[model samples]
Target chain A: MSQYSEDSGYVVAVDVGGTSMKGGVVTRSGEVVATDRRPTGAEGGPENVVAAIRSFVGDLAARGSSLLGRAPAAVGIAVPGLVDDATATALYAANLGWRDVPATGLVPLDVPVLLGHDVRTGGLAESVLGAGRELTDFLFLPIGTGIAGAMIIKGGPYGGTSGWAGEIGHIPVFPEGERCACGQTGCLETYASAAAVARRYSARAASPATAERVAALTAAGDPVAVKVWDDAVEALSLALATYTLLLDPSAIVLGGGLAEAGPLLSDPLAARLGERLTFRSAPPLRKAALGVSAGMLGAALLGWRAAGVPDARASWALDVPKTSAVP
Target chain B: MSQYSEDSGYVVAVDVGGTSMKGGVVTRSGEVVATDRRPTGAEGGPENVVAAIRSFVGDLAARGSSLLGRAPAAVGIAVPGLVDDATATALYAANLGWRDVPATGLVPLDVPVLLGHDVRTGGLAESVLGAGRELTDFLFLPIGTGIAGAMIIKGGPYGGTSGWAGEIGHIPVFPEGERCACGQTGCLETYASAAAVARRYSARAASPATAERVAALTAAGDPVAVKVWDDAVEALSLALATYTLLLDPSAIVLGGGLAEAGPLLSDPLAARLGERLTFRSAPPLRKAALGVSAGMLGAALLGWRAAGVPDARASWALDVPKTSAVP
Candidate 1:
């Protein structure tokens, strides 16, 4: 263990998803230890979801301490929707059916708490430890079950004055097309999200195949799947192109489940973005590196930072204790 | 005169435009007391334009000393295009026909010089003293012969990392629409600029008339006039709606010649924007109060701040020595 290690010191990180609650202990160097997952129990109300999170955190802490000999010193949690970082409040989360959730107070641990929006926290991870680490200005856009993004300006995440700055998914892409779950018509998420891709392919193909099968068909030159895939790429390109003109980022990092397609996504997106931009430099398109662990790593970083750990080195040092209390 | 105003002293403020150069002495209280104008003479080349500005400043200083009763302490210049405010460098301005214009040495002023983009400086004036003074996070969009905007974030203008933050007019509105002078297709300016309104009305009207005449006829419910007017409103609304989702600004201040249409522009724009935004709050739309002098006022404010003029007092008191020498 390094000089900064404390026997009772740990950093807890949680990612609150629409369907599940995933969390773990993270050492200062961006490593996840003793991670655990459970259904969000969202339909059981916010209290039940909190109870699940508490249980998850308790189990992770027990396992992490037994393995590494430490108790957490601080905690960080991320959720979807409008967040009030200044107040540590979850102002709203449409998917989780939460409003003004005082996340900082909900954690039973007597430690410093940090709260952030999920996509932004994911972006924080990318900006600090992923593909965007070298770029001062970049947009971290994750196209997954639903589409969302975070803007990094001058190496810092920019939450608009209202904390809704990176809601690019809500922007109308098709003008008057299909209605979105958000009650809007033709939002980018309705067309470009992973779920949207599957739904669109299923509707068009009428063969009722899984998204993976659709991707396979698209690769094999199936016309219906090709058309659906092309439309998704086109929509994503337009959205990204619009963002390039507006923000002029140095690069764009594509993450989330759908990004697993790798070059299948990056190649077409780069071409479309390049074609749209004339006078401005077309930012490079890259895939996110941290993968599914990005959110927890980011949340842990947030926790360490909130506890006044200045840099990644300090966090890493705090991860492993020099001595074990049980021994 | 104010305390800082001394006879033979002067402050230079330059307004760099697409086709011409306008500049003058700006009083400490945001007033332009003496002014000069000349063709930017870009046809002679970028070097010639710089030489013209140098001569213009020298001539203005030589002639306006008696009128001003003091030498200027600082200079503030507003230019068109991307400007890196941190380094005081004009990164790129297509209209000015210059790239990376080093403003510090270009102006050739002895006093402290403050440089800012023309539209952003105008936005500063609007935010401090014009239509948007009461609101935070407002957009100042000026639609004249061309279109551009300045975003006021958290009560200060956001000069994007490269100083190209507020290019709202360049965002693509129609993917397959007309080509823009900027070599892009379907830019908002191609459809909504004052020049665009005149051109569209001329091409589509049965008996073509001046934009003023078209405006009058549109007021009287002529079908062609109404169509042209509605199309412009549609483009502007779409652009503003996209901006609303991105920035969530509190209000939008409309300036420049097109704003003179008053209710003809605002009423339809409000209705269209409202129809488009379902989840987000629709920012209030209003006309700019500074009108033709917004840039000048902004320039003056920049001069005042650069000269170390405090804002607590409304006016400055200057002592001028008696002098009889005349040029």
Candidate 2:
């Protein structure tokens, strides 16, 4: 038995990562009709990755058709790249080695399609229904293997003049500190990212350790882990302090792997951020509500937007907190 | 006596600074029919300053009436400190000792009025008819006694979530460096501001030197002057690198007293800014075109905008480059 009728409008939404892609059949009413996850085939080539995405979109649409008795009205995809929204093209994706892929070329059907930057699409989800729901302007930072910010300005993601905005990870925090892999000195990512935390702790401890393990060790009063964790917090506080003074965002929403440490990260970051900012009060720190599903759900909203349903998220009666994880 | 006819419309424009206030009558054809300058009366307090502003606005409008044979269409003012655009209130002025002075209260006429923040208003002039005329997104940085930036986004000045967005001066560039007058450590203003440059040079050279003298000495290969200038350039490079990574602006328009150093300041800053960025090209640094008259011109535009003449700068040609100095 289906909750949606045969005439219910639906769209195909996909979130494409470097390793894998997640595709879903989303109805206009915000129901997830079906979802499928698969490898992006990026190791083969850009052509193979495009083929994988096309196949995934077709498969999801077919599943949606079987459930709703109709083809998808439109498609929306979130990809790791610099997107040219005016031309509906993915300008470049460093990880996937893809460039200038038109939105329509990725879909098998004759439906309209939309494409967005991966992190910014996730920020859209956070802004619409996640942690930044009430914030009109804020920074959405996902601290994982890497760090980048989605600057949600005036209720939407601001990509700047050339869609190269929000590259906060590369901003130099310690002007005289260690050299970054990006060839810059003292980049915030060199000390604060999840991978960085793990690497620094492992190097000091003379043993391999994950960022999670390092966090656990720090909690258990391990000296090396504590030092590494403290450095991360200090670097983040400096970056956040700079961000606050320049942009004056109402709040800063934290996401991705490191945020999962909960109070361990937020407590120290908040204290130092306050100390660094002398004139203005630091913006409140918040936990991301949607977690990993943010990109897919945001793609769904994009799908509905492409289908000409601009108020798609408005009618969504979702219980996001209750269904935190999707299996 | 007047160049224009009786039907020619005009507006009163004022730019209020910490020490002095300038007033002008701007015709619809972009003509400055009359101009006057007076002290802001800050020595007597906020009330006297408000009275001075009110008297200036009335005098300018009366002169405009004599030329155009009608009451002025509207008034526009640029004031220091925080301004609330929505409520048309000068929220606070630290130097002038004023708080929440309404725009209507500053004008003694039955005409519409508008207000703008001083530096942002100057940026608006640069954006409309000056150096940044062709740019839609850029930064207007004035490194005077103090430092601040006017972030022009999407063809207008963006004040951010709380109208405090462009505090680029206060961002901590050197986390463990010297404390600033604002009580922050390693703030960009502490190292890069013209006042800071002069003060630093005087302290090291055992003699007082203006920023201009420091620039000349740096050019003449004085080691102390070179070191102080180098530190300023280094701090600027770090700040600009962070801004570029985060915002991706097209260009940076340099103004204020330090910028008058011209290539002496911009050349080294440009080279260092380029060196700091590892992933992307640095935004080109351009000299501010309007020099000191930017605020008054922007006020005139605001006056036109208040009079419902939105595209006020479309007609009436003026050679900005040739007429660098207003007097």
Candidate 3:
């Protein structure tokens, strides 16, 4: 609902995933002025992916200037990997097959450039604009392909010393029970992540089905689906209970694909987490409202922050976008 | 060696433990001008303990006034419990058998008073004067009769909402492996706490021996002691590794009674934690340098802050106290 006028400046924001690159031109008030996308070309090699990102940013910049009558004041990029936000460098990304790439330096723009991890960026967006609004302390957990967390402490995203603070997925929930791709045992992601649920269900059911289908099947009283779904809920709740004992957040916002299951996910998770916690009470578990566009919006907010705009005016406090992508 | 002149000012600081109450009259530079101790009288129940604390603080205030040639500027009390640091209220202390006691109100003093949890206060002291000095991000784990942690973030103590942020002791390490007194299963404290080590050793050896004696026995090649010590180290390392994956602390400072085991505790712990970590490197494990007086010193620091004094003048950067009690 935010409108951009002639005087309103713009920021270019991009969110790079394993398969696609999402880019947007956003006004100061967080309105999407223009948008674009491109295939990551990841399978082609790291150089191809890097080149694609450069072309995407260039296109967005040109489109932004034409739409806003001026070039963007700043650019913000979010990538899925071990990103060092302080230096705007992608330290390492296994899926992207890149390391030590200075992402901010790759963009040949006149404005300031900022870079951050994809999950943290999405959490920041949700915290400021979606379900987490008005809460200063909470955890934004995105149960996507692999589980990750964005810790919102004192009203802002908290990246640990090595920019790897919210690796909640890697926390051993089963204690040497199952091996993880990260060379760890019993990681929460190994059992509870959306990809894990689908893969495990498919292996047992002898047919490939998305996590969404598994949830539907469980609701319809499918025995195998029920077992798999119950296990995921139990693992998630246990990990959350442990986190509650450590940080004691005010609430936990469940985002990403798995959370889209709505009551099916929240209901069982609440009951299990409540049972696990004895002394300390379990925090409210709310679903994220921003959907998939959260990463792009969060990147835009960071762009405004890089342009020295205050957080209050920089964030999107408007209603959630109805479309799957940024409006 | 900070010399207390008549005009320099002083504060009364108390650290109330399960067995004894340690009180001190501290100068501006963390020097203990006078000190006293009293039995907690816990067997007489909560009211008796409260009365003892009142008498101890009143006596310390009188002694401090006489020693400094003026009344103390502030008072700081550190107790083992669920404390509401903002309101100076002791919410609950299982050891002290008190709940919802307004400790500051009981002081009946004109000076500002501050109350905090014992572990967090020790962490604050370590952050300013000991191993954690100059580090903004770290975890302070004290393996005493019960395990607790003080999380130092952004160069200051972090007391979570309701002042229960660092209850790492209660985190289910074994997940239904052992029964803890708190009615939990396989808690980190159940296996790794100093009291647990001593009690387990005493139970199995059929002769009473403290955790210190068990360490000595392990060094002398006692099979039982070696097994018990190895299990303790494994449990502690597992819990610490999980914490590292979550918080990514720069270092972990081990304090309290068990840390007195020195290399026998740290060396094995460091190696085990390093082996457990895959993507992220293990943080350095360091023994607490402030000894048992960390609580008293930290309380004094809080007293100075409460009295509106600058930190440079309030810190004990001069010398390490050699005496068992505060010097």
Candidate 4:
């Protein structure tokens, strides 16, 4: 917990989501000395959310300073939607209702700041410290309220062309299946997202239930729940198979709420994904190690990078090893 | 016809396909000083094909030696297989019936040699000299007897974790549709390959017709031909949409015999692709500029790369001039 100058050695790491944001004060040696969460005030619109985030960063830095006696060396942030990492700006996030919000606007501190796309930042954490530790190329797929993937190519997250890459949620997995909220037809997210799974099951079942309840009900052989779960699995199988063929990922790291169902989801999903690939074997699916904290940890890595300590995570060797222990 | 030296400026280039192989002697300045073609001898077995390639390469080098007053400086071969470029070995090609064939086995000359996968090598050519010029990321789709793609990422072709990255044609576009020869159901290849287009049209129409003839008939308003063509276009739209959503490529370059239909193919594909992508504009569909010569030219680039001249193609302006090109 004590490395460098203790307080001054840590960085303020934040993961900003549409509904809420998670913040932490993390040391260079991969220790989270202080952590907190707060509502993003998104209901009050983009400016309110920005003010909340800036206040949160200030509070975290002040807490760290009190704990160890100095200001944080740098700040790292993860935000939803399009990000221009080169300029450290949040280009656009439809859900956040913001465009071109510079990283400077999100932090009250005067230290070096860096930004990353929310999903890709989580992918970076998974790549550096979690399920994908051994992989140079893989897909980090987080399935929760919505689905998106971070394509880890040549050991880093790849945001193609205009930073719009990894919109896997919007891809049409079942071409004639259903309409998505984004106005696309037969999207994978329409059936496979945790929110979608619960929504779909509730629309057909006798009672409304969470995705967790749906998983348990399906496992207990409830026919309606089973049908809904099977559709999600089928949709995922198609999308995963397509990803495998196109990217040939070493493995797929699954995280977020849907994955907490554990083997109940992985077992059938794995079998179906294998069956779909005719010429090549299916890439193994591994559970994410960092879970919901991946983005925050990844921001810590970005913070470390900003502080000119690239090997800090490497030296710590926390959580998982190069030969990942996620299983 | 020459740049480095009049006596030794050229390299031997070969594009080895399942049925035939194209060979060329290309100078550093990007001129094909001589060219030839021959059977791959695949039916006679892998050894026969290897021996045939060696003889063909020797003959091309001899021709270049007489023309340039010296032996070629390097060799580049594009094979239809999984290639370990780092080791210069062709690992496997089901069609070519080869395994563990070293690049040296096909090149009698002692100069440096490099091997690349057929599709990716062609994509490299497209990236450096053809339709994908000036673009850092794009998909080069060639709809021939079969379908495959070259995913040009970061100004070069990207082969995935195990050199199988761009198998775009095998993606399941229609989940419950026709089974493919690869034993996968609803593959883009099953519905959209030139052979598939010709075969489907022939099966439904009174008379048999080639894919080129089918394209002509579709243009002339033949219902059967139009149906087959439409299915191909629809399959293509779905695959491209999926690709765009996943990779966000700048453009998609269409090549091969079917692409010669020009507006007959691109017009409907562009419209349908745009319709499929609700949030993002569809990437423009461009015609592949180099045609059948793409693979051979890519092999030349590989040859120059093997000879330690990475910028040989950049030295010559083929399409849109690179900003670094000399005045």
Candidate 5:
């Protein structure tokens, strides 16, 4: 823990979700200190979301200054959408109902503020500090409310030619299978996301129970739960197999909510990927280590870099706020 | 012709096919001169192939020296195999039965000799000079005896993370389709390649005279030929659509023998791709302008670049060898 305070420059990392906004004072080594959260206020409009973020940042800064006696060097924010990192613009966010949100300018920080897609930022975190630390090439699949991914190539994330490189979720996995929110039919996300798993369980058993209970019942040999789990595993495996063939990543880092299922997901997914791969070496499937904090940690790293810190290694020098008393 | 001579230096480009070896003295501007050809003598082994290539080069050098009043600056060879341009090693050549053939060392020329894959070399020519010249991001899909492609990204070719990036033919188009020579089943090459089309026509029609006649009959509305043609187009379209979704190239340049079908191929492919692509912009389907000489032109450009020539711009130089001279 003493290693956490070696460098004392503040960087604000914010995770903007559909329902909530999470902000934190992240150390250079990816440790989060003085964290705060608030409702996204997205239903109220873009201005409300911006206000919430501003307040969150203000609160975080005040806490940091009171504790550490200095202001943050930069801020990094991660949001769910088609982010044009080159232009510092959120091109579109279907879930948040925001279009062309100039997030970089909206953040009330004199310091440099960097913006990136939520999944990509999570992938960056994985690449720098988690299972993908040593991998020069890998794919980060965040299986949450919606399945989307980011392609990590030679230690850098590929945003595609149009900042839409890792839209693998929208790729047609089962043609003519199911309608997706992206207006596509049979997308990989429709079958493999956590939402998909819960939907599958509900549709099969007509159960009103939470997905957590479904996981429990499936563990105890509930037939409908078992079927849903199996289908989710199969769908995930198919998508993974396709990714393996395309990018041939060193590994597939599974993150987000559904990955919490652990062996229930990894075991069957590994087996299915093995069955499909013939000519090439099948990549090892691993669970993401960072959990929910990945986005924050990644955003912090991005913020540090944006502040001219250079690389992920430099992120370790971030200043931690020294509070008079532990919060 | 005078401008071609002034713009390009004397360089020799060789296209090493399974059955034949074609060599030509190409100017820096992509014009061919003192062109020569000889049988590959593949059965005589790597040693014999080297001897044959040397003899061909010797003949071409003598003619080019006399014609241009100097020996060519460098030589570029395009072969059918996995070529490592960095190491100047041909990793594998199934048709030539050569593994790790160091053709660069084998060449007796004092000038630099650069080696590259035929399809990739062809793609380079197309991207720099042909239909894809204006597009920074595109895919060059050449469907000859076999189907393969080269991805052009940001004005450069991506040799995959493992230098095997352009094996688009091996990508499974139909999971339950026919077995391919590469040990995969239902590859696009099995149905879409020129050889596949000819084989399908020969097998089904039984009374086929030649591939040309079959093509003519197909154009004349023969039922058997039409079926084979339609299936070939469908397979090619599916492959193209998959590529469009994956890379989202600006254009899909159709080369090789089947591309000779012109509108017969492009119109249907465009329609299929348009139907498949929902959110993304549909890339234009166009014919490769360089034709057979595309390989030679690419080889020459590679040689020029390898030789450290200051102003290597072979693609833009209008020195195309007439089609009638080769095909």
Candidate 6:
């Protein structure tokens, strides 16, 4: 049943979100040999989530060993929060109700483990393997459950002081807009994130629906859907225009679930961004190529980097793999 | 008599603003040996302004030769607008009525000549010799005739592609705000810039006053002045909060004419910035130490760098000379 060669090497890449933990055993060239997904059970509290993460890492290592006839060379985990990646500490994750959680120490594996910010890791994957492959300066914004940004400057991710750069979601768009859960008012995410889109539409629509369904309804010319969607687009444009004037990235890569709506999101967002700008031209708006897998793959890239693999060698994974290399 | 020796090297520094051109011959440690000032004559057109800059550079070079017994080693100039620092071209300066002007080529100097964007050069000076000394990450905002920023990341200036980064003035702070000269509505400069503050006050008050006088009137409880000042503070705080969330700088350094008001700007700005931030802490706000001379001093630093001077050696000029090296 094992397909991987004993001579081959691999790393465990995991993305831990509010709802679930997704992981994979990835080869040096970024090929995913196998994957595992499970509920985070955050409602049970921080201890339960930590235990789940530990068990998942163990399960992946065991699975990799069984499939490859050897243990993984390293492990990388991506988690949301104000993470201090250097110390592998999840300083705080509001969604998970945890603080100062040492995520790296949770894993039982003997191999080296690295922890990273989930959004930044996703951005790294996009920067190297997906939409931002050739861009030296760009922003990878994932409009998933919430909106955050991964700033790529001079071909690498820029983590501002304390590794908390790119918290663009918290930036206020409307001076007197609605209050945010973050104790702030009129945050960009409150108006434009996937969660926001669905919550707003559901509040007024005759039939409650997810952001995806709202997009469909909007396309059908439902006045309420159209109005909500347009407001979201406008808010996003204003925030992005602010970002453009400050950083002037070459392009913006939209990722996460909302980005999956394709042209429906990209077209209007791009046009509105253009209208918002004055003298400065808007960079091309692009969709993420790797979809939900960007975070997992980005985690693998971080692992490979931690393992001291050269960027040139790491980038070889971008080419479609011809085989599993398990002979 | 010049204190610099015949053997000692020097650089000519010029800061070209919309209304005036300030130039000086500076010793390596940032001491001004000889100085000259002239009207930019921008109203006479780009060609006239170009002639003034050439004369200023030439005058400083001659003054340095006569004082120090030798010509200066190099020259550095800082000008406004969307400067292509790499090409040393003034791409477009609305105030100067110039487009695609070769600034570096205009200065008929044999030694190496360096040209930089005016605000960025001032930021460089602050980073090395003024308030931001020893700080690794900070933003240098000079709110004078207009508001522009110089971003210092990892101890050096970050000029985005084409050297147009830090154009924070253009960022729309008000959606339905006043129309800006740049063809945009409700830009940050439209409300908070030094020029805007004075102009807005003059439009409302029976007697026209500078931003400094407006600050005094606001302190005296003049309702109109208080209202205008509060609006500017709010708009500036909003922009700064956005910046803080995005970059998380260690500090924010305020420079230029408006900054000269000291506590009037810093106190309200710090308090408002603190109020606007939720999870993130506000970076300490500080006034620029070098005052109006920051641009000229930064230009000298640039020249010294272009002339192969190390930072350690370049800083030696900070020590006031007891006697001219010419002795």
Question: Could you list the iRMS of every candidate?
Answer: 1.8, 0.8, 1.1, 0.5, 2.7, 1.0
Comparing 1 with 6 on DockQ, the higher-scoring candidate is 6
Ranking by TM-score: 2, 4, 3, 6, 1, 5
Cα lDDT tens digits, model 6, A5-84, are 44458888888989988888887766688877888879999999999888988998898888787888888889888788
- Stretches off by above 4 angstroms in model 3 are A1-3, A312-315, A320-324, B1-3, B205-207, B313-315, B321-324
lDDT for position A273 in model 1: 79
Worst 10 residues of 5 chain B by lDDT: B318-327
Clashing pairs in 2: none
Cα distance off (Å), candidate 1, residue B43: 4.2
Better of 1 and 4 by lDDT: 4
TM-score of 1: 0.89
Of the two candidates 3 and 4, the one with more favorable DockQ, higher being better, is: 4
lDDT of 2 at A182: 90
Per-residue CA lDDT of model 4 for B34-87, tens digit only, reads 888989999999999999999999999998887777888799999996999788
In model 4, the Cα lDDT at residue B27 comes to 83
DockQ of candidate 2 relative to the true structure: 0.87
Model 4 bad stretches (over 4 Å): A1-8, A320-327, B1-8, B319-327
lDDT of 1 at A192: 82
At residue B105, what lDDT does model 4 achieve?
89
Clashes (N, CA, C under 3 Å) per candidate: 17, 0, 0, 0, 7, 2
Give the per-prediction TM-score of chain B. Answer: 0.87, 0.96, 0.94, 0.95, 0.91, 0.92
Question: What DockQ values do the models have?
Answer: 0.51, 0.87, 0.71, 0.87, 0.31, 0.72
Better of 5 and 6 by DockQ: 6
Q: What is the TM-score of each candidate against the true structure?
A: 0.89, 0.97, 0.95, 0.96, 0.87, 0.93
Candidate 2: list runs displaced more than 4 Å: A318-324, B5-7, B316-325
- Give per-residue CA lDDT, model 2, range A79-138, as digits (tens): 987999999999899889999999988999999899999999999989988999988899
Worst 10 residues of 4 chain B by lDDT: B318-327
